[model samples]
Target: MSDRGRVPGQDYGVKMIPYEDLLKHEPLREFPEIDERTPATLLFTSGTTGPPKGGYHTHRGLVLHTLSTALAVKNPPVNASQDDVAMVLVPMYHVHAWGWPWSTMLNGHRKIVYPGRFDWGHILRVIHEEGVTFSAGVPTILYNLLMHPDSPKYDLSRLKFIVGGAALPEGLLKATQARGMTVISGYGLTETAPVLTIAYLRPEHRDLPAERRNEIYLRTGINIPLVQLRVVDEQDRDVPRDGKTIGEIVVRSPWLFREYIGDPEKTRNAWRNGWFHTGDAAVWYPDGYVKIADRLKDVIKSGGEWIPSLRLEDLISTHPGVNLVAVVGVPHEKWGERPVAIIVPKPGYEGRLTENDIKNHLMQFVEKGEIPKWWIPDKVIFVKELPLTSTGKIDKKVLRDQYKDALPK
Candidate 1:
């Protein structure tokens, strides 16, 4: 029997078994012949609402996902070279890391694994020592590196490209680009092998003003070839592409996983009518780019309308004085569910900000009616830092656990 042990700093444990012992005892004498429909790997959905469910992807599905990603990033348009060494900073268990490992290997690029928890000093050291040319990580990881005191100590000149996902903070993208790094914002989910679209810089945008180019890069780019993406309303009808119509993003892709393992009911609901339901609410730009507003479940319904918490959090995070922000719905008898802004102020800016300052800052949106007055946060709670998940996204589940009880009755 295999024994399990936990990796340092990891919440979960892994089975301990030597490769030699495995070969000796349980080695496959003859490879099992499996069809394209056979299950290859099981990916657990990000448990934002409930317990994580295992989503199964077939070998055929994964192969397509890997090749398509390679073609999208390494083709003539982008031309990501095989000489480039990729520094993967995300957790190995994450679909982004696991899926890209095969893609990078297939493309003949050198893979430099971090092999441990993310530490800014260690990541910088690895980047400098390994002469890493490409890096892929979530926005939070990039934010930490860009803001770290020792960030300037290392020579990051060899870095050529960076891909941000799993929550792309707009301010972080701007900061990365200002530092002369070529940053691209992408979007995907665990069910899609975590890669659906990347911010493909259009040829025309290259010559545009820096501010304009940056704005385009902040939105998710057009769908990769062979993927059909649409924003639909409650009745599954398509929403407009005028850049203001927000709807749930549903995707149909050759690379999408077949079903959730052992959960037929959820699988049925998630794959209703053969489309993988992302549960993420988004808007499609006139330029064909998509911007995710918030998770449908996370969208705060106040005064009979939806207030996208993700968009609000992104806007709040842009403030120079704010280090992190999480907007959550609290019990509000008046508006049904009112927003509460939980903020982590920048190092020197603590105790200098008041609720009115935040309110005044968000007043521009209120004036435009892009955000309703009732949707404005009812309270602002200052905190040291936002709790983050293993994947670097804000851990909203933890935030709810900590503050749900304190919400006004």
Candidate 2:
């Protein structure tokens, strides 16, 4: 294996030890006694919005998270077992790959496959060769896998995917379904030891039709075991479970970081009223499920009304011509900010996907009362490709910066 991302190129003050040389020494005869609250590791945030912040996890927290995550995948629709193999695609440096390195051991998975780098074709080959049955990654990674040229040649029928880092789009979900792969949505953040929710079906709803089932799978999901999640307004009051009232998602979990390392003010602001604020806007439903709208900073303020970028992007992604899409708000004199869609067209669609075509596509949804007519993007710009963050999510911060002044007064 190539030691690209693994090797620290610079001389950092600490000495490095080779695995082979370290094993030559005898094992420790005794272990040191330490409190469970002792810090185990410190991981920095993905920093898609701004500068990365450090969050430390306690030994106790990681243990609980491992158990909780193991339980989550074993419950209901997932029912992960020892027969299953895991190819964890999430970066290990980010939230410890959603705590799977520990959880997989707890779950006693049949095997674990690690792809040193995210070469899509190589991943497909690994999946086929290793008989990989389960995987977890951001939507972008899943997108690349499905769009790969050799995707059809591989048998992904038995594969199950857990998608996080961003909301899963309907089009992508359906495409995966068509390929006989099971995909579920998940939601979390860096500070919470990251596994907040997984969209697994309840026992009662397991017999529902495919369309109904897919709707549930597309949601942000309900709280995982031991995770107390709530959607609250600015006053910190719980929002109604009407599935329309948007509120910030606040969470209380055993594994959450106590503070943002070295940033006291941010730490205080994040953990207010005894909950860690996720800064993600979402809606609560009577079914006890939460559906994310957009990040608080990414929500577009148009004519004093909130236009959720995620919902718009989800709808637009279903268009046949669009391979990848990002909806961002640009400054507008009359409306404060208007949505503009940046798209990457699929092969054979370049230069053919026009603004009018997108507006017309959205109109169908508007007519069905699925989305408000006024929510349509004012402009659509096709791009060769969309920018991605280190964690493989759409880099909305970069998009916003690049198009901050895209609109004319």
Candidate 3:
């Protein structure tokens, strides 16, 4: 097998194995000897908080994750037949891609591996030629495809479904659905072997009103079987399930990773009481669905109150003039930290928005007391585009490093 690294356009420096060689290799006689506690794979955390940590998963854990995710998304004997072909768009190095490759193989599907880097033209061509029925990608990748000037040049009707994550934006989902494609949003982290919950349209919900169904589509989704989830407070106590009470999300699953590699102390802290703590703050709906609000570390703490950065960013992105936006915390003496929004305006719309316009739009929320007056961003930085990570999420660490020192004393 040839081992290569760092292709020109790829971000994560993934190692690619030729499809011909992969087909010729003999299957393993037995699964690797790994206990429930042994490390099967090491996935690095997103590191939006401080530094990336490597979370270790076991062979059994990964298998559980795969089966549960497949069941949640309704990939059954019909849609995902043994003869079905799958073209993976997410890089193999990412948890979404890494976990899916094994899951597809386990289900006996034919896999067409894309070489390093995502070429939109090449991807469309391969799907039609290979008769690819299922695909997995991040929302950013899908957005690029749906907006590509040549998208109509390729026949994509054969695609049955697309599993999107790694920062799924609402507008991206709507755009894909408009093209007669089914888009499923799933939530997970590298630490969990990455498939904890999936947004599936329940059989009963199919007959519901169009507007009601659309509301369900906006939620992150319900938990898959065998995974126990709860929204908790700082004291590790469960929060009310009124669908409005916000708390940190914690999970206990058969597929949970053991701990962060080489950091037992952190591992012990995160896995306290035998439950893996997800630092993401979230809320649960009355119907047992969970919606992630923001990362605890990323939440802006202003004037002894918490502001959900993810919610704010989502709201800002809905504006037609805004292309992309990231909300970051800027140091403050009185409030401890305040929010600053970095915006990339849509083409030809730059310099059209003023600070007053933003405040005016947010004034409606201020009146409802959903947000305080002080929570408004101190300043807005306009840019051509936001820097993204290998997985396509905003690279907040890079932004922090660039602006952390520039914060006012």
Candidate 4:
């Protein structure tokens, strides 16, 4: 190992550790009786809408999560096994990079690429050079990759992506699908050993029409193995599986983090009612799939019905002139609250994007029964850019604060 001088953001210098030195350490010849409940690792939650929290997990939980996840990929679009190559892009500091480090090892080395510090150009090069077949990251990572001008230089048709960190919008999903790439959504948190669900289609839907099956890929998905998930209301009762009843998502998983470190009050609240409250508001589907519409605090309560802010954002994202978009609930006298859209138009469309364009685009979905008329935003506001959190998700808290009064009394 050689020292690499001083390292940024650290008090000490960086050193490269060699594999020969690592293997020189004493090895355990025989296994000893060990309790799987021992504390394994600590991870910090992304905290997109609030302050980040520390979460801890156990040995048993990690193994189970790794095993279950490996088994899950054995079927369907991501038929991962010993032959598949993996290039995990999720930040290592974030939920064990969605637990790929250990999970990938269990399936043996199928070629792994670690492009340190996320160079977009380098990432594209690695994918092509290493013959990378699979990868996972937040939606932003994928967006940047596809949006990169040099993206066309690389043949990415062989790659499959597992999106998480935030909801995957229909516009983004379809864009990747058009490229003949395998794109799917997964849902989890730092508190749940990180992955509780992935949007893999069921046996019945596998033979369905292509368009119909593709729609399933846009959902937050059904719970993974051993995960007991529920979309429930204030009374802690499961909401009707009508695919429109919005409710909080809570889960019971063996691999869930132990608790929030140094925060008892928050921990208690998180574990209330015998489940780990995910704070995600989603609709329950009859097919056992869960489509997350919005976070509870981010849901727009206009009139007596609930408006999913993410849904509006997704619709706006499809506009040709749009670069990015965010929807928030604004105060109103009659309805108590109303939806307001803040959009970032493409460079040429700046200040040219009109409120009517968005409303008219959304009406097409409404006319098709994709959404209700009341779900439409009351107003549209153009913006230079949408605020983003440290993790690159749209910072809705900032948006709410800035536009809370967008709708007048």
For model 4, residues 1-409, the per-residue Cα lDDT tens digits are 2113211122122233444665778866895565677556656677677888876677789999999887776667787777777998877778888889888778775787787768898899998999888888887888778877888798889888889888887777877877778999899988998899999877888898878877788889889899999999988899999998888999998998657766778889889888999999999999899999998888888778788898888888888887777889888999988999998777689878899999999999999999998888899999877787766778888988888778776
Candidate 1, overall lDDT?
0.73
* TM-scores vs. true structure, each candidate: 0.87, 0.92, 0.81, 0.87
* Residue lDDT tens for model 1, 296-369: 88888887888889777877777778777889877677777878899988879899977788888788778987
lDDT of 4 at 263: 77
In model 2, the Cα lDDT at residue 57 comes to 74
TM-score attained by model 3: 0.81
Full candidate order by lDDT, most accurate first: 2, 4, 1, 3
| Ten-residue region with minimum lDDT total, candidate 2 | 1-10
Clashing pairs in 1: none
Report the number of the highest-lDDT candidate.
2
**Distance from true location, Cα of 143 in model 3, Å:** 2.8
Better of 3 and 4 by TM-score: 4
- Per-model tally of clashing residue pairs: 0, 0, 0, 0
Winner by lDDT between candidate 4 and candidate 2: 2
Query: What is the lDDT of every predicted structure here?
Result: 0.73, 0.88, 0.70, 0.82
Which stretches in model 1 have alpha-carbon errors above 4 Å? 1-33, 75-79, 96-98, 110-117, 157-165, 364-374, 405-407
TM-score of 2: 0.92
